[model samples]
Target: MKQKTIYLIRHGETDYNRQGVVQGSGVDSDLNAMGQAQALAFYQAYQHIPFSKVYTSKLRRTRQSVQCFIEAGIPHESYEGLNEISWGAREGKMPNNFDNEYYSTLIKNWAAGHTDYPTEDGESPDQVAQRQKPVIDLLLSRADENPILICMHGRAIRILLSWLMDESLATMDMYEHSNLCLYKLQYDYDTRRFTIEVANDSTHLLALVMHH
Candidate 1:
């Protein structure tokens, strides 16, 4: 039985994130200064791991989160499949009281068996899950001893984990993804199963907080 490991990460914060604005697939925001520090901190901590490949979403934030590794000559590929879910009319909107209330109601509806229901022109949870298929498939097909690193958005990470665990996407809200947090999963080729080794871990960023 061979074991394959995967490191999953959520992209660091963007200016939109700092400003309490919605940054979905359509927004395409870059990492802010704090975000850059978070990325560097993550890299400095995990550089010891010999990552065979790197994967990221087409968005700038995901790629920027791993920019250090990419610049260090580590090979990587971008996939649109890993992009964040669209928030439609709220894509780049800074949340006001009304926006906040509306967003909450929207999420409430989605959780109430309306997963396919969209807010404005935004994507439904089902649509996000659909695009995540290829990313999941690629992970399952990898050979043992190959360690892959992936950087994507918060919602997308939750969707990927839900799919991998064979759980409902509605339950994805249970997983909390902080900036630069990581999850580690080990796949056993023999049993054809994935066992989570780490979840929502941000211990590596403790030292970096003083600077931020």
Candidate 2:
């Protein structure tokens, strides 16, 4: 039986992230210094793995997080389907009482299994899943890219994991994540099933000293 392993992680932090600003799919931002350090730590720890390919969201933050692996000559590709869910008008906003209240309500809606609920001028969880399905199917079919490394954003990673783990979209928050956190998974081609080998692991960043 052919099997594939996926090393999936959230991109490192950005200035927007540090400042509590929303950076949805629409906001293309760079990694901050602390983020660069986190990336280096991850790379130093796992650089020896025989990763055949590197996959990331089209976002710069995602690409920058795994830049080390790409620089090491691992084939890399980015896909829009892997981008973070767009927050529409709130893409660059900082949290205030008003926005925070909106977000709280939004979160509650999602938690209540309203996966179809979307932010104003943005995408719903279901819509994000629809866009993601084709890309995931296409990547999984590529037998040549086994044991690939994937870098993405927080909400997007959770959504991807929900379906990959065969759970309802409402259960995605159970797969908690932080900047540079990892979730390793294994897929069995014959059985068409995926197993979670690791979940929300960030041990590699334990020694990361945040300067700033």
Candidate 3:
């Protein structure tokens, strides 16, 4: 059976990420200094791979994170469907005392099988899954024999992975994704099963990290 491979990449760190703020689709920020280096490392690592196509979210963070790859001559596309879920009112605000509690409750609800429990002005995990599925399906359908590289936000990537792997969002949360990390998935066209070949690989960023 022929298998299609998808390489999922998390966007490089942003200023909000460095400050520990909740930054959703509400604000579009560029990559921080560390992020730029990380992106360069990622590009260098995968420059040898023969990627069929490269995809990224419409957000600047994801765009800037993958700029190195594009500059290196890789063909790329951007999709709003790949954008991160809106944090709404919480956008750039630091969480209030009750906000953390509320967020925890929401996660609990989701883990308990409630996919519709959304934040006051934010999206639920299920909603994100719904929005991201079509784009991913389109990619999978078009490139059944080619490998694709996708650059997207952390939360969006997690939601997409959960839907693709048929796992609960909570389970998907157990894994951590660093800036410019790479994850690879192989999907079997015959069995309709997707297997992870690699997850959260940051070895490419090691040299840069050690030096800086």
Candidate 4:
């Protein structure tokens, strides 16, 4: 029996993130300065992990968050299935604005256990999980290539983990995912099961965000 390990990370923060704007799959943003520092800090901490491959969403933020590893000559690929859930009409809206009724409602509803509820023209939690199925399938198929790193979006990361853990998407929010935080999963080929080894760890980035 073979064992495989996966290191999962969420992309660092972007300008939209700092501005409290909704940036679902509809918006493609780059990592801000602090985000870059976070990414670098993450890399320096885990540089010895001996990852054979890197996987990222087909989005700039995810790519930029792991740019350090890419530049270091690690082989990587992008998967469209790993993109964030779409926010549709609310893509660029600020969270606290006076007129953003639907956005607020959506958040409240999602938190209130309406995970299947969708904003107008957007994706529901179920839909996001549906699309993410392929990425999961691909990872399972490549279990022989152990110790791969995946950089993706926040919401998408939660969805993927839920699927792997055989848990409900509603429970996914129980996990915290700060920028550059890592989640590690171990797959046992013999039983064809995955176990969570680490969840939402950011200890490696303490120095980067500490108050001076």
Candidate 5:
């Protein structure tokens, strides 16, 4: 009955993130200056945790954010499952008034529990859930008695957490994560369950904010 833990981290900010553009599965983007700072802070904050494995998305932003952990001598793995949702045609496109309206309507439908609402070339909420479930299961199964660190995009993290917690995608939308935010989940082998210890904690970011 050994305990297991999973540390879920959202990658730092990107240029597109700052610009409020949809980055979907377009060409990978690197972190901005603030994002680099946040990633470094994340490393400093959790250096003592002794993570058994570090996982990150294939996207550049997530990989870069966790690069500090690799430099610190932690072994890590990357998975495409951890990548953000594909925005299809909207990838890297700056949203105009019309685009904003369309995106907002899509989001509103999703928020109202319409998981199957089709996006022109984007994945629906249910589709995201389906894709992430296998990855979540794999991570959970491998976390027998060790702690794992997962670095991924914001939307991916949210969808995975929603599935893990058995909450609806609509309800999960209420939770927002800032760049490099860290979330902790502890699992009880005896009960075969996991509980969230912390959600979207950005204490390290706050400290960096205060310092600068």
Candidate 6:
């Protein structure tokens, strides 16, 4: 049976992330200095993996997160379907008391299984999952691309893993992640099944701790 290895990671942190501001697909923020360090730490650790291809969301932060791999001349592609969920009116809003309350309520709703709920003019979990289909299909359709490296957003990763693992959307939060964290999965073509090898592993970032 043919098997493929998947290395999935969330994009590095951005100023919006540091400032406690919301950054959605529309924000298009860049990574901050610490975020860059984290990226380098990850690349230095995993560059030997010989990734057959690299994938990232259309968002700048995601591409920046994997810039080292791309710079190494690895084939790379960006897909809008992998972009972050839109926070709509809240996108880029600095977290104030009201915004904090709003986010709490939003999380509450989602936890209650209202996964289809969206912020005003924003995207729902279900909507993001729908759009992510093609990129996933493209990755799976290629036999030559093994050990793929994919970089995307946090919430989007949570949602993506929910369906990919056949878990209910309500439990997506179980897939906790941090900037540059990696989730490893194995896909078996013969059984048509996916098995998780690692979840939210960030041990690669230990190098950064030594740096400081």
Name the lDDT of candidate 5: 0.83
Residue runs of model 1 more than 4 Å from their true location after superposition = none
TM-score of 5: 0.93
User: Which pairs clash inside model 1?
Assistant: none
lDDT of each: 0.86, 0.92, 0.83, 0.86, 0.83, 0.91
- Ten-residue segment with the worst summed lDDT in candidate 2? 203-212
Any runs in candidate 5 off by more than 4 Å, and if so which?
Answer: none
> Number of clashes in every candidate structure?
0, 0, 0, 0, 0, 0
User: Can you write out model 5's per-residue Cα lDDT over 1-212, one digit (the tens) per residue?
Assistant: 67888888998988999999888766599999988998988888888988888888888898899898898888888888778887677889888999988888988887888977767777876887887777777877785538889898877777777777778887767667888988898877688776889988988788878877
Higher-lDDT candidate of 5 and 6: 6
Against the true structure, candidate 1 reaches a TM-score of 0.94
- What are the root-mean-square deviations of the candidates from the true structure over C-alphas? 1.5, 1.3, 1.5, 1.8, 1.6, 1.0
Model 4 TM-score (2 dp): 0.92
Model 1, 1-212: lDDT tens digits are: 78889999999989888888889899988898889999999999999889888899999999999998888888899999999988888888878999989988877876676778776788888899998897767766867427989999988888778767778777777778998899999888898777889999999999987755
- lDDT score for residue 103 of model 5: 82
Off by over 4 Å in 6: none
List model 4 lDDT by residue over 1-212, tens digit each: 79989999999989999887878888998899889888999999988888888999998999998898999989999988899988887788776555377766766787777889986788998899898888878887886677899999888888778777888787777777988899998888898788988999999888975842
Superposed model 2: Cα runs more than 4 Å off: 209-212
For residue 26, model 1's alpha carbon misses the true position, in angstroms, by 0.6
Give the alpha carbon lDDT tens digit for every residue of 28-113 in model 6: 98999989999998999999999999999999999999999999999999999999999899898778898888888888888899
Name the lDDT value of residue 72 in candidate 6. 97
The reply for model 3, stretches above 4 Å from the true place, is none
lDDT for 186 in candidate 2 is 93
